[model samples]
Target: MSAQDRLVGAATLKRLRLARGWSLADLARAVSTKAKELGQPLDASVASVQRSVARWESSKGPILPGDRYQLLLAHVYARSAHGQLALSVGSDFSELLYALGHLGESERRLNDLRTLLVRTATDGGSGLLALLGPSTQRVLADALADPSKLDEELLEAMGIAIRDVNRQVGSLPFVRVQLMLTPIVESCRRLLDGTVPDAVLLHLRAVAAQAYTLAGRAAFETRDDEASRALYAAAAGGVGPPWRRAVVHMSHALVTLYSTPGIEAAQQLVDAAVRDARAGESVMVRARAHALQAEIAARAGSARHAKAALALAWYDIDSDCDGDPSPASFSAAHLRGFEGLTELYVGDPSKAHDYFAQSAEALHTPRERVQHAIVSTDQALARIRLNDPEAATELLHGCVDAASATGGRVAAIRLRRARAYLRPWRREDWFADFDDHLIESFGA
Candidate 1:
């Protein structure tokens, strides 16, 4: 068959629709309806759609609407099962979306999809892990003036979409997720003015809080301290589920991770998150809060507080390893890397060495690459503290490449520390090479 005539593997499409309990006919109806709605010029009469779906499933011909309906396909197949499947539109999906009145939401969805697909492939792992169901806890409808009539299905779908966005974090750019949140927040505002049930209003608040949290992180990653702090507070305000509120505090605490003089404030924020996590009985979240506590304590030059926080972190993490992995990245490897970080900054270099060595080997997941890159820089830092310039140079090269590639904030902060160490070795030829590469990668 010609390239356009060939099927895209019916099993992939079938499995996608089937996993969501959609029948072949149901799939055709959805595709056609969406295409028609978007004025995509579809002959979506029941009979035509039937023939198309049949040919697609039988591998006799390419599916109709599937060829040029890249966005539609994304809506159905963005989740994992077959793979991180999506077709390039040969043009920016954003422009077409703007024309079709889906600009922000499309940017959000496609960017999240890109984060899940492109970033993971860049990192390493099974590539584009499964898309979990949306939270069903919230929904928003922009331009829907009578959103009071909004049904539960759409609300559930938004909840799921929020959940999907959750998966893309740490694996993708924060700005990508950040763009789509404003519309949803606006929608939530409109819905709040409507006749939503008491329960649904609560769910909307929770999702709004989450939207705020994601936006806050994006701001934090870009080093916009003021915006990050403001967004985090917005996330905590108003009523929401306890678990989600707990995360807000944790995310807010992380805002201080790179601040040399903000350790005291960071500790207070983390302590607040820890208290909320404890109240919500969110043990894993508590573990993360403690880990941040340890880091902040280390930064403040309080070895006792750091050590105590580290111990509690281990206890909480061990207490809940059997549960589902977090929607965000917090692998055991990262914990070790965090430990190595604490050691390098607050304890002995020799001790930091062993933790980073193990952490590096375990840093193979798609979500862990940013942390992987951050750890590499810190490992270089540890080597420098141990007076191993050559060893440090080798590691710093990889660190620079990884950070530059990901626009990693953590890597940027670590690079400042690495520069200080390298300056002392400026007379060495190896230092010259490292300095030249650093300039090339990050621009002096």
Candidate 2:
């Protein structure tokens, strides 16, 4: 069947009406009244309008409303769903129809969908380059048909898109970043299906590897460690530079560290990442790899080893000239956070608090919400260790606020850690408040 013959629009309209507990006749009357108020009076009587509404919401005769009727219908539900969909979708009737069908009765989903559409429109489909508009679709179609058309410029553009999405992983909402990265990763997979010419094969693989690595990060942000591991493995299989391989190895190690009980396996992966970094002469990668190594050592309660790794990490970071790329990039603040964790693990609450404070101060405002939340929770844990449950609870509330908006799994994990540390004071009023807020924001 043709696209126009689909019952998607009809089903959307019916669901929207039913969700409000409104009948066809009620919707018709509402639309008629709204149209007159909006200075576009419907000439049809209420009975006629009701019949039209029924037909509009019918599958047998799936006909879209005219522009005037659409406007009238939107205005009728202006305070609710349809009107908001119209405003967000603008004059693109097809998009409006598709969004209506896609979102169903979830206002939250509608808002998310609106943000995605607006970002796609304003950002020139930067993250969604694979699903670009007609012109780009045409170009991609030609490239897919004949591999030579996947030129260097296009490959570079794809690389930039991958980097852009990678940068959004920590800053943007997890769901939004996941949504943006999925398509790029899928597109890269298709490109790497053995069709590209030998001239650009390695370059294409490099870009594809970057895409997979970033997607792995997105999955990790959502706490989907299994998927994250698979994506990182796919990235490692692709032919890329030594630095890129280091990034993939480090990413895989991170997921393994958190998700599995295989500490030795995680250590081996991070060790490989460190070697790759040294081979590539990337001090930045070395810094990040060592930071991960320090964390692993700290988690294993090897205070001496952890401190040694942190010292090496600090030295590498100081000597680093060029910064790392988005997917596996490390900043001074990140190193400090790792230092804070190491100090806490080593039974130095005061030192951990000092490191976390420095990290918090160094973080970029508004853009580092997730990182800030994680740091706050870690600092709170330090406060708990210092016999200050009230201060820890206060910090946890702030973490809850941050996670409520961004749905950051990293922040949630830190919050869980803080909660565990506060278990001794769980019966206290402040602890109750913190625990209740955590459950409400994240879950039990």
Per-candidate TM vs. native? 0.68, 0.69
Give per-residue lDDT, candidate 1, residue 179: 49
Reference-based lDDT, residue 392, model 1: 90
lDDT (Cα, tens digit) per residue for candidate 2, span 294-410: 998998899999999999999987873654443336778889999999999985999999999899778754447778888888998899889988987887898899877877776
Candidate 1 residue pairs in backbone clash:
134-159, 134-160, 135-159, 135-160
Worst lDDT run of 10 residues, candidate 2, spans 84-93
lDDT of 1 by residue, 1-444 (tens): 233323334444554566657777777777677667557757558567766666655555444333355565544443333434322221122222222221113344445444544444324432211221222222222225566656666555555555555555556665554544445555655776677766566666666676678777767777777877877877789546565667887777766656436567777777887777667656677777778888878877788888898898888777755553343435566678768878977899988988998898888654566778777788888888898878998988888877776567778778867988778889989888888888898787
lDDT for model 2 comes to 0.72
Question: Model 1, stretches more than 4 Å misplaced?
Answer: 1-144, 180-182, 189-195, 320-329
lDDT score of residue 176 within candidate 1: 51
